[model samples]
Target: MSASRPVRRVDRQALQGLAHPLRVQLYDALVSEGAATASELGRRLGESSGSTSYHLRQLERHGFVETDPARGTGRERWWRATEEDLRTRGADFEDDPSAAEAYRILDTEWARSRRGRHESWRASRREWPMPWREAAGESTSHLRLDVEETAELMAEVVALMSSWAERTDGRDGDPRYRSVEVQANVFPNGRPPGVSTD
Candidate 1:
């Protein structure tokens, strides 16, 4: 999980646009589903087509998403998240009241996810028809490295992960493996115990 290099940095305008609850949900839907038409997105979010389309245009205007690449013959615009991940200064965002609006986006997204899972009893935990499910595992290791070493290690990890993503191109995909969910992160936990990991 530690090795993949991030491809782009999301900036303030993009963050601000994604700050809206509907837009954020739209973003998540696009990212998870790969691409969706405005009408499809509207139905998924329980909003009207006009509303979804307007916000989608706003998203495109700000470059949060673009026309999905696979639609070669169609005239309909399909949208998806533009960047590899959503990023922000967590501490800074938490400190300012205005910045806290971003949390609304996240909260609404989570609520929607939960609502979809339990929308009905038959569809409760029993439902395997949902488009996707998530799972994760974590590990920690102690390391002593200067700033330069830390940077080098991160870059090497990214290269290795990208190489793996590349090498998988030729592999046979099981029908189940068509959807791949992978996330990797490495960040400072500050000085570990007594040592100045600073």
Candidate 2:
């Protein structure tokens, strides 16, 4: 993905465009499930095709998605999420009230979506194959690291994931294999042990 396109630094306008709940979900579905027509997405998301199509256009206006020519026909159009790594700098919106609010809403929705997806997976894990079930689990650890170290560690972990991701790109010829979802959360606790705020 890095070789293909540069990272997309989402600006205030784009961030505000994606602040809509349905639009965010549509973008998420496109990225995770690959390209699809608006109708197909509507079916999967239990929304009207008209509604999905409208929101898809809105997403496109902000460069969040684009037309997928290979998947389209005369009467239908397919869309795919951009390969760019979308990022927003919180500091940019620190002084702007409106932009900050938009950022807060989008950020909150993102976190909520992650939690919801994980909970859904937990609920449905039993239906999956035994091998997958055995391989899937979560753990919590208390790490000793400052802010900068934590960021560096996360960057390393992302690089590792990017490498692993290349192996699963394109069609799945092997029924024995499945796309796995990996999630990680790292943050600082309020002052480490024996540290005084004063």
Name model 2 segments beyond 4 Å from true: 1-5, 171-177, 191-198
- The Cα error of candidate 1 at residue 4, in Å, is 5.4
Every model: Cα RMSD to truth: 7.5, 3.1
lDDT for each residue of candidate 2 in 96-130, tens digit (9 for 90 to 100): 89999888878787787788788989899889889
**Cα error of candidate 1 at position 20, Å:** 0.9
- In model 1, the runs with Cα more than 4 Å from the true position are 1-7, 72-75, 107-198
TM-score of 2: 0.85
lDDT (C-alpha, whole model) for all candidates: 0.64, 0.82
